[model samples]
Target: MSFFVRLSLVLALLLAGGCASLSQQQRDQAQGIAVAARSTEVNCDRADRCALDSPLRALGGQAMAESTAQAPRHYATILDEGELSLVARLNLIRSATRSVDLQTYIFDTDDSARMVIDELLAAAARGVKVRVLIDQLSAISDVHMLSALSGAHANFELRVYNPTFGKAKLNYLDYAGSVLCCFRRFNQRMHNKLLVIDDVLGVVGGRNYQDDYYDWDREYNFRDRDVIVAGPEVREMAANFQAFWVARRSVPAERLNDVGKALLRGGVPALPEASFLHPERIEWVDEEAADPDFINQAFVATALPVQSVSYVADLPRKHRRERAEEPLAGQHLTEPRLDALIASAQSEVLLQTPYLVLSKPAQKLFKNLRKRDQPPRVVVSTNSLAATDNPIVYALSYKYKRRNLRELGFNIYEYKPFPLDAPIDYRQLLPPALDGLPPVPERNRMIGGSAAGSNVRGSGSGRKPSVNGSEVERDVLRTETRPSFLGTRAVNRPLPVTRKGARMGLHAKSMVVDRRIAVIGTHNFDPRSENYNTEGAVIIDDPRFAEALAQSILRDVHPDNSWVVAPRQKPPVLSGLNYSIGKASEALPVLDFWPWRYATDYEFKPGPDCPQPLRRQDPGFHACYSAVGDFPEVDVGPKWLLVRMLTAFGAGLVPIL
Candidate 1:
């Protein structure tokens, strides 16, 4: 045989072998495990009407009035760190004798995530019906982990809320399809985080199933807060879960066969077998556990409830005029609620937040109080430069924040790291140096004493100069007038400006109105949260509850735990040069505003070394910049980017990804 022919045959053989191996791998990954289908259905329309007229009506009304009273009411404690919240959540799941419904934004394959999975599997093993509904985007992200949970138990049933097959994987052909699907899926995201264990106990809050949220790592521990309800409210949360569960977008886990087998082989960690068959060892507490005397004082001194203590959110309208101006506007308790609650306020409005970037409307709301005939004191606590995990967000925030709020005549405070009694060190809280060094402050000293006999100006230049003339004159004057001017002309110095208020507490997001009613929820007052992400929360009506939560925040949480932003007496002054530079940066256009411009112009551009002619437009610049700029660079690597592109494109067609 000729040498050329032999080489061709060898190449063919190698290609064929590679193709067989790839096919088998794909087959192995695609194998699906069957999941037994079971669900608990509650008709909310019927219940809503029945609830208004039933004996439950009187119970809910009375409960609303003295909601904070120490009755034998059920409540769940939200622990902020470690496996504490997970442990609490799992314990409730295990104790369930009837039905368990769990819904979350993200469920990972991490230790804590797997632990919950194992427990759910066990619950299903014992004939306790368990339904798990997770967002498709999140589930597909952890398909392997979720599939393992599905394969291990028949009683366990899982569904993906909004799934797009081609969009989910995005191999080469799907990329084009995904682009067409992007628009419909981009704005629609499932931001609800809930866990309803049985129709009796429920928890709704901000924390997600990630390590950073649980405080497993000191560097990323989120200072967050959540609420647990034990009464009829649990039923409401359960219904919310069902509404999303049965929605057209949701699909059973059995549908994703390929993803399931991979997860099963990976094997979800097994739950430790333990019995909490009795309630005694559960460490569970009810409303009665809270001191009654303190509870009574809280109720009697409680301020009126915010306007419409119970309110519902209106969905975004499809038509322009009918659309709610802001989809998230009514999610929290409104300004009328704040007014009624804040009416009796005497001293202060203290706010603690990890992310303290407030919108223009929010800024106006806080500023209006300072405009009052006799404005009450107001203080804010937020993260300093060194303490924040999201520096980009902080940079964009502090850029216009202080000056705007100060201009509105409100005292703006920034959190600084210092001992509780120590003064703030303002320079330390400035954006951290890239090389990790403390910023040096420039000194400008003015000398005017009789011994010196003249005014002298010390150079305002930050760096020290080599000149010796000023030092010689200063030495002679220091020796002669040191004793004469002592205690004679005391310089009236202001308090040492400290950066003590810059480290805001974590995870707890709340608004206290007149120390009366407090609105606590998973929503952070951030642009990403307000405009981009979906969120939910409850507006508690009880004054005692609000006061207790508020005091807990101000006293225990805010003092040593949080940094305080110092309130400025006047608006911050910026040079015209700086103002112009800022305006120019804001005016510059970015690609997120126009998504498709980059594909042909930048993405398909050939390399310079290649002999192929360069395209007139380098679409790669748009593609490259858009990916780097718009999406969070962390955790989402090249492969994830490819997936995101494909998903986004697919979402454009399906309207659900």
Candidate 2:
């Protein structure tokens, strides 16, 4: 062989050898981490058995009945922004002693998630057992960060429910592939957000870990709700987490150690302490000495055995080939607590959701209520164009508000950031002094004196400036006492009232049922939420709680946080001829009455009417359009053209099933 040929062979051998070395290193690191995690696995089942004689067992036995009996009487506190609630949640976590189980759909590595993980790590450091279960697909985006969290402590265990190796990677390719993957395992996602601390307190609601969720940014914040239960329901939630944790495809963090190390090297921070490990020191009560009523109302729900209680969940089943033959079917999938509450409603339905894009079926349900003569009065509150974080979704929702009011026959209101009317405090406005005040000035004379002088000033000005000043002076004082007392009473005197400040954004997504049940969840009544992302919520069946929530929605959420979008007989006129001319110049063909085109592509340019960017920022430009330019319109073009294309596309996707 020639010298060149020999050199090429050597290079190939070295390259292959280096690859093998790297692979072995990864395998070794993974095995080491797995061994460490396995060594820390305590016999939790044994611990549960040991604690059977404890007060917890007695408390668990009566939790269900107590809950059912107190269902109608229970009062709920609404935690608006996740930031405020997170502090409470973390405090609970820090109080954990025996066990900590947490399951969520999304957990990012942002400040909020870090704060939680730091506490969890601290718990683990104190020898408190911890387990974290997250959806496999949802965690894919943050796997590196999660792996780092898992590696920091042996007491901490992480598992991903329903691990999809190759298929999940394929999902990243395109939308079509993702849709196909969804059909393959329609029952896969673990759509549960539960946190059980020491098996004593549990929390269930619609909140995920993301910056936007906690109101960290000024642009937008999710209007969501969650409840913290300190009773027997926590055990059920814990069991649910356990089942998912040990499922067939669940991948423990230790098993992913090698991958985690690689991920860390690629720059993911190590996990901190477990947030809720050691239980906080508190006064303890002997089981025999504890107050039954206290336990019944706060923990047990009623004097009923937990074994007799049934917990319902929307766990989908694996689709068989035979089942695929039927037309696609969606199940009723309603929580009993939620259904009961909705069924018991009597007076009105007041809903406050940041995202209120309802599905066709759900819309029809609301419409049917209107068709009946006894339709409950409805008030739907949501974000305005200026308040919404996602403009695209906002645009889509804005188009439907009018139709919902007119066709559905419901009273719809959008949240206005500004107050409608000023708050009047009659006591505060008691005229500085009720009596002995100097005579008030005359309106006509004062106006005339301030303006270019008139000839009337020649004779009228000299009249001793009469007490206050001319005929207008006496009229002013007379008008002060009553409107008609003024001279000639040419103009009407307005009432002495003050205006209040505008309300901020409404961030709670809830519905009141027959004034009986209240449904609060993370799921917005939006297409993307229903069809695309997995969601979860909790329904409480307490009339008092529901009423309080409803009142809050109306008084705080609706009045303070939302803009009331009312219909106008005429389109608002442009601020200037320049604005009208600009709009006319930019108008697309067949724009008016174009539903799809208008809904998707309609851009509210920052004209004088709209909130425009400051001139310092835009320079020569008057205002910027939507943060994302008119891409939807550019993609679909003219309104008429988009309608035809969308219609054809819908027809095409139909046969693919």
Which candidate's lDDT is highest? 2
172-197 in candidate 1: lDDT tens per residue?
22222333444244334455677775
Q: What range of 10 consecutive residues in model 2 has the weakest lDDT sum?
A: 447-456
By summed lDDT, which 10 consecutive residues of candidate 1 come out lowest? Answer: 472-481
RMSD of 1: 21.9
List candidate 1 stretches off by more than 4 Å. Answer: 1-33, 36-83, 138-140, 164-184, 256-352, 360-364, 367-371, 374-379, 408-505, 555-559, 567-657
TM-score of model 2 relative to the true fold? 0.57
* Model 1, position 447: C-alpha lDDT score: 15
Clashes per model (N, Cα, C within 3 A):
55, 42
List per-candidate RMSD values in Å.
21.9, 20.4
